[model samples]
Target: MTLSKKARSISALEIGLPIFAGKRFLDKDLNRCFGDLEASGTLIEEIRAQELAPLLKGTDILIDLHSTIKPSVPFVCVPKFDHPAAEIIPFFNTQHIITGDGLLTQDGKPIYADTFVNAHGGFGITVESGYENNSMLVELIRDSVISALKHLGVLQGKLECGLSRAVIEKTPYPLEECTIWDAYWNVIAGENFSWTKPWGNFDSMPAGTHFATSDSTKLVAEENSIILFPKDGANIIPGSEVCIIAKKQE
Candidate 1:
């Protein structure tokens, strides 16, 4: 099933409260407007850095649970160093572990929760519990947390094991950098911008094939490339990612 349908299935979080409340959780970056702080630029960042950063600064271990857009097997991301985060990988049901030298993209963007928390002297790992809105997503989070708590000695119980003792190393899929040329809000009806084919994470397409287009302008594949994060709809904004053309890691 698609991620949107799965997310919509959870009526409590997706529809129920937001019906009367108006604003939804994903409507804005709540971190930026945490309180009545009407500041801008450096001052706003500085306030959050000093005040909010301290709350997680002293935390011994932090697990940031998140969801993805694709149907993914739950996985954990740990820093490459011989840290405590890597030691607890076998306790849960997840069979994938991504260990990075530094949790930053080639463009220097921090891609994992461990990136922020590790800077503040806390052992942190990011656990992606499959697609956001999946029925099993919460169960994955609960299982991971419970297993971790037991492992950390915070809770006493026989750990309920789910998966076997092997984990897929690093990332199952590698992403390549795709430059954003432009974003087109308008496209030809029933023939607007979209992937040339039905795609999964890391599904490859060959060169000279058109991946997406708005009007007559097409983003042709530059190489034998993989499609990443194919959007469900054609609502495009300026600077939004159209596609990341990548090849399999040889």
Candidate 2:
């Protein structure tokens, strides 16, 4: 997500208040998002070449952290199937879900890292820390970072229990190419999707069950598998439609 000056003000305030009050570590700005399109594009490429490339060369795991406007659920998104890191994280645990495909931006653009990694060669994943400026979400990110570092052998610690096994699928789902027209919602029924049941990619579904609808148009799941991350917030618009993510049977 693009961070504005106003947003960064809140971010700085949040980081400073905790540390000024006697937190153990001081939060440093890794990189700030510049609103300038040209500058930001240059920065992204330079960072990829000078920073990320060097660190990730020959590395097996990478974790990218991002904040979202969605509620509390954390999402671990993998663009490719069968990645070592993707094969380790759980599909559902503590409100976190491991997903492969979904609309990454409000503009209906596919995530860049997926394509970048395929071309450059590395395993990368995006970890969505839910709801902007939330302390609990921030803590969840910190914990996940610590756990990931330990898993990578960068940190030594006792492993916690109930570490769920990763649910891997044979075939990866394709990301949908779509455009957003306008925002719409069902008046009688709230939100057009469900996540109450834990479904894996390629998991089965009844043929006639309504998966989602826009305007008067309805969509259904062709086969059973876990549904990937659902569109959250006011991100989905009227003409926006996401390609269904399906996993092959285990």
Candidate 3:
């Protein structure tokens, strides 16, 4: 989600003119542009070392908000399975929780904002809260942030985590899925790419089924796996991710 929506909402609530304007926080895409602090001599570190590293480090707890490419239900993504922040996953509006396996990016760098925060000794959780223009998303985000603050004692209020609702712990990728993504993932031009099925987020694909294709190269599932973040093939970049193969977690 963009900060401009929240900024506008806050300003509108305070004043009646709706005169508040929202601006992009960073000029560049901070996720792909920033380098992992653990690695040495990467382009991200070379360029953003002095600028971006300080903003991520030394935070007590971090909650990052992201928008999904496809329309999706809200979900929580924990950087690692063992972090202290895992306990708060059930507090959000979603039932799904995805945990990372500490896998490095294809460039041998960590690409996630929550990963950088957690790596630097802070408890961090990433929340993928549907689409950016979702009508109810702004309210959901504000309430979730308030809930987190209360849970951490930063705000003095009643907790609003969806305690009465059940939560599902998503499993990490199976070995076969990881191997396929590492080896067969193609950075194709997404001018005409689209999923064969109208697959929702985290929907399972059977073995030997086509996922998506562009021109002559088609991506098919090698085994039973679920898909994550299947992007709508619109005016997207060539290197943008289409989707990830995963296993359904109980």
Candidate 4:
């Protein structure tokens, strides 16, 4: 009796949208189309991650919802640190968390959609939920979809939200796991890239700070960093990942 059911809210911009790019996806990045599902690789997010990877194979859990290309704050991502969605993410109220992240591609495996629902064993859960004109990014994405449906018990009782209880009386902010070490790729950004400042995701950044340059080369932040997923001028894709610099996992 592994309870709690009913999921499905998907919106890769309402089905892999890319009508002239604002940077998110067109033929890719439907969270990296589950390893490019090749039904002739018929784009449109590789046939929507090949019909949503057979409806997440035998699903058990999968939260995934994101929004950040600049502004930041809310966070959550899991692909490791013993992911069972990292044991229900401390019941999420978001204070930031990303753990054991690896393959941002050295020739594959960024297969996100919560990494293909954690490669079928389920328990995925992404949730960046910030940025996109943050005005409390819509009540913190409706309180991270009601705390990932009340700690995955699949929500219940008295609802009718619109936020107000100061998001369940604030407090959050102490999760911090972070992790990844350094990322900045856009593989020589085709002879140009930019961003010397105007950071975002977790921000901090200290040791050497310089931040970005690319083809002219110069990316700094050698240590004492935090930034995550920056994507400066967006036309990216030269091996992708334009920013990542986590730290605090200790």
* Per-model TM values vs. the true structure: 0.51, 0.41, 0.63, 0.31
TM-score for candidate 2, please give it.
0.41
Sort every candidate by lDDT, greatest first.
4, 3, 1, 2
lDDT of 1 at 99: 48
Model 1 lDDT per residue over 49-68, tens place? 34544554555566666666
Q: CA lDDT of each candidate?
A: 0.47, 0.39, 0.54, 0.60
- Give Cα distance to truth, residue 2, candidate 4, Å: 5.9
If both were scored by TM-score, which would come out higher, candidate 2 or candidate 4?
2
Q: In model 3, where is the ten-residue run with the lowest total lDDT?
A: 8-17
User: Which portions of model 3 show Cα errors greater than 4 Å?
Assistant: 1-28, 36-50, 102-104, 157-200, 214-217, 233-235
Each model's backbone clash number:
1, 12, 0, 0
User: Which RMSD values do the candidates have, in order?
Assistant: 11.9, 13.6, 10.1, 15.7
Looking at model 4, the pairs that clash are none
Query: Please, what are the lDDT tens digits per residue for candidate 4 over residues 1-250?
Result: 2453344333232434547366577544566557656446766767777776777755666666777766677777766545434555655566566655442444545467666667667677677777766766666666656665555456654466554754442223444443333333222243567778677677777888887777777877666767777666544655556666766655
Model 2 lDDT-worst window of ten = 178-187
Superposition error at 207 for model 1 (Å): 10
Candidate 3 or 1, higher TM-score = 3
